[model samples]
Target: MAPPGDSDSSGKKSVVVTALDGVINVNALFTIAIFVGLSLASPGQRSLNSKESCQPGILTVKQLVIFEVLSFSFFLFSSLVAQAIKLSLNLLSSEELAHGFSVVVNEKILKAGMLMTAISSVMGCLFLMISMLNVIEIKTGMLFCGAKSTIISVTFLIVLVVSGLLVYISAAWYAFTHARVHFHRQRTGL
Candidate 1:
C-alpha cells in the first residue's frame, strides 16, 4: 500500500492514503473533529440554558451532530466486526474438521465477515450523505435529491454487494481446492 498522502505515478489518490493523512496527528484530529462536534450538538445538551449559552448556528450545529453521530456509530460497529472476525479466524484455524470441510468452513466464515464489513461501510456512507443533505441549502439539497445522487448511491451499493459475493465465491473455491488436495494426499498416504 502507498504511504499516506503519497500520490502514485498514475496521479490517482488512494483512499487508504487519503484516510491516513491527518492535517495534524491522528488522535488530535479525531478529537477536534469528531468528539467535540458530538458534544456540542448532542440532543442531551439541547436545553434552554445550554442552548442559549452555546447558540451554535442552526445548519452548522445540525451538520456537526449528524457527522458526529454517524462517525461514532460507524467506528463502534467496525470495531465489533473486526473483533468478531479475529475470533472467528482464530477458531477456524484451530478447529479440526475433515480437511476439505475445514477449509470450506473457514472460507465461508471469512467471506461472510467481509460481506458484513462491506455492508457496514455502505450504510455508513449512505447515512453521511443523507445527513449532509439535511443541513445544506435548499438548492444544494434539491440537487442531491435528484437522480444523480440516487444513481450514484445505488451504483455504490450494487458494487459493494457484488464484491462481497465475489469474495465469498473465491473463499469457497479455495476451500474446495485445498480439500481435494488433502483427500488425494490421504488416499495416497503421502
Candidate 2:
C-alpha cells in the first residue's frame, strides 16, 4: 500500500503536468505563427542586377543580397528567443511541480509570445519596404526622360503601397488568431 500522502501528492503532480503541457502547446502555436508571418513577408522574389554590371546610379544585386542577409539574421534571432521563452516556461513548470508548488496563472507567457510576434511582423514589413524601394529606384533609373521617370516612380509607389497593405492585413489575421488561442486558454483555466 502507498503512504498516506503519496496519493494526494501524485494527484497534484498530474495537475501540474497537465498545466505544463498546456503552456508548451500554447507556446508552440505562437512560434508557428511567427514563422508563417516571416515566410509571407520575405523578399525571396527580389533579385538585383550584379553590382559590377549594374549602372553607376542604379541599385546593385550586392546591396539586395546584403539586405536579405540582414533580414534573415533578424528572423533567425527572433525565432531563437521565442524558443528560449518556451523552454524556460517548460522548465519553470517542471520545477514548480517537483517542489510541490503551484505555478502562477499570470499571462506573462502569452504576452511574451505576442510581443515576439509583433516584432517579427514589423521586421517583415521593414524588409518588404526595402525591397519595394529598391524596385522603384531601379525602375526610375531605367527611364531616360524626366517625365518617364516620374511616371514609373508613381506607378511603382502605388503598387508597393497596395502590396504593403495586403501584408499588414495578413499579419493582423495571424495575430488575431494567436490572441484568440491565448484568450481561450485563459478562459478555460488551462
Q: How many residue pairs clash per model?
A: 0, 0
- C-alpha positional error of residue 98 in candidate 1 after TM-score superposition, expressed in Å: 12
Candidate 2, lDDT over the whole model: 0.46
- Model 2 per-residue lDDT at 22: 48
Per-residue C-alpha lDDT of model 1 across residues 93-116, encoded as one tens digit per residue = 332432433222244554455455
Q: In lDDT terms, how accurate is model 1?
A: 0.42
For candidate 1, the 10 contiguous residues with the lowest summed lDDT are 181-190
Off by over 4 Å in 1: 1-33, 39-56, 95-106, 125-190
Deviation of model 2 at 61, angstroms: 2.8
lDDT of 2 at 163: 83
* Candidate 2, 34-129: lDDT as tens digits: 444334333333323333223324233344444555555555555565556555546644533434344443456555654664466456445544
Model 2 residue 106 distance off true place after TM-score fit, in angstroms: 4.4
Top TM-score hit: 2
TM-score of each: 0.37, 0.41
